[model samples]
Target: MALLEVRDLVVSYGKIRAVKGISFDVEEGQIVCLIGTNGAGKTTTLRTLSGLIRPAKGSISFDGTALTSVPAHKIVSLGMAHSPEGRRIFPRMTVEENLRLGAYSRRDKETDDDLRKVFDLFPVLAERRSQPAGTFSGGEQQMLAMGRAMMSRPRLLLLDEPSMGLSPLMMKKIMSTVADLRAGGTTILLVEQNAQAALKLADVGYVLEVGKIVLSGTGPELLTSDEVRKAYLGED
Candidate 1:
């Protein structure tokens, strides 16, 4: 069975529906990317999976547990972590402080080991461990956001627009970290508008438009597909 399964998921903002019955799965040890334009429900889908937003109609199963009814805080304890869009870090807080909050759901308050692991993943974060998050560059802040989420020691890591607002060099660093995480056994569900980069790194790819999946395929397959090439890759 897939590590994370989302079936017929629908989400709404009052009268307007943001997600209309989309479904996908993330297998263990693979990177599955959902690539789309802005406002295509990619962020909304990740938010719902994180329990920050409830699905109006659908089911989310993570590691064999039904997550639709689970609260946001509780969802973190179930081995799923969301590094949301916008790199929502606690600016005033120290980098360590921000990362520690991610482990709040864990029964064990001892997070030293996890902290070390996250630092290893992002050495710059380790260098600025005591600095206020607000003082860092956008790329640095993004690293902290992903590291903070990692403090939860999740089985399934949900990444939303991780390459957003980053330089080519910075974006490459972040993407490389993603591959490292996968190599270390973290199943990832990624949402990105940078289709070329995301699709190149992904094991599987899904194309979303207006809250619905328009296509699905392996990374190489979708990269070569005419539809994805035109719509997302900016190729004629």
Candidate 2:
């Protein structure tokens, strides 16, 4: 069975529908990416999976448990972590404090160990552990956001736009970190606007246009697809 599954998922905001009956699955130990332009409902989908948004129709199953009605806070306890778009770190909090907050759902005593692991993944975070999150650069903040999510020891990690506004070098660093996470056996569902970068790191790729999936393929297949090349990769 897939580690995470969404079937006929539908989400709406009042009279307007943002996601229209889309379906997909992420198997264990794989990086599944949903690539699209702005307003394609990529963020909405991640929010729905994280229980931040209620779906109007359909079901979400993670590890064989139905998550359709789970509360947002409770979802984290179930081993799903969402690193939302825009790197919404607590600006006034120290980097260590922010990472601690991500373990709110945990009752175990491994938080310190997890914190160390996060610092190892992004060594810069270790250097800035005592500093306020707002003082960090864009790439550093992004690292903190992802590290915070990692604090939960999640079985499934949902990442939304991890490379939004970083320099090309920073973008590469962020994507490399993602690959490392997957290599360490963390399942990931990534939403990204940078199709080339996302597809390069993905095991499977789905293309969403205005809330509907228009194409699905393996990473390399989508990278070479004519339609994907024209619409997302800027290849004429």
- Top model by lDDT, which number? 2
Clashes of each: 0, 0
Off by over 4 Å in 1: none
Clashing pairs in 1: none
Which regions of candidate 2 fall more than 4 Å away from where they truly are? Answer: none
| Residue 188 local lDDT, model 1 | 92
Model 2 worst lDDT run, 10 consecutive residues: 135-144
With candidate 1 superimposed using the best TM-score fit, by how many Å does residue 41's alpha carbon deviate from the native? 0.3
Estimate, for each residue in 1-236, the C-alpha lDDT of model 1 and write its tens digit. Answer: 88988899999999989999998999999999999998999999999999999889999998899999899998888889999899999999999999999898888856999999998989998998999999999999999999988999989899999999999999999999999999998889998999999999999999999999999999999999999989998999
Candidate 2 per-residue lDDT, tens place, 199-234, comes to 999999999999999999999999999999999989
Steric clash count of candidate 1 = 0
* Cα error, candidate 1, residue 130 (Å): 1.1
**Over the full model, what C-alpha lDDT does candidate 1 score relative to the true structure?**
0.93
